[model samples]
Target: MPRIVSAFLCAAFIALGVTACAEPAHQKHAPQDPPDYKGVPTDMTPPSMLTPSAKPQ
Candidate 1:
């Protein structure tokens, strides 16, 4: 029947339109580098040592 054919055509058009309007799900994120604290001193003094009065009252 013509009505059935038209219904199928309309469904197909709607599917194609939805596919065309939809964006690709794939995304590219920028590569991140590992933290590099190579030159920082490992044996730094505590903040309390820098200011003696910073102790608990």
Candidate 2:
């Protein structure tokens, strides 16, 4: 009985710790309008998804 109770307590503590560490939900910024493309290149990959080109300095 004591072992079961301790195990339950430990499991609960871990769950609480995970919940506390999570990022809080909040209202995100409204989407921005697309920028003018006249001067910009047609290809626009997100910075995070971009890979380094083979060309070196």
Q: Using TM-score, give the best candidate's number.
A: 1
Score candidate 2 by lDDT.
Answer: 0.85
**What tens digits encode model 2's per-residue C-alpha lDDT throughout 1-57?**
999999999999999999999996885887665786456667777887888678976
RMSD of candidates 1 onward, in order? 10.8, 11.3
* Per-prediction TM-score: 0.46, 0.44
**Segments in model 2 whose C-alpha atoms lie over 4 Å from true places:** 28-57
Predicted candidate 1 versus true structure: per-residue lDDT over 1-57, tens digit per residue: 999999999999999999999997887886665588456667789886775565686
lDDT on C-alpha atoms for all candidate structures: 0.84, 0.85
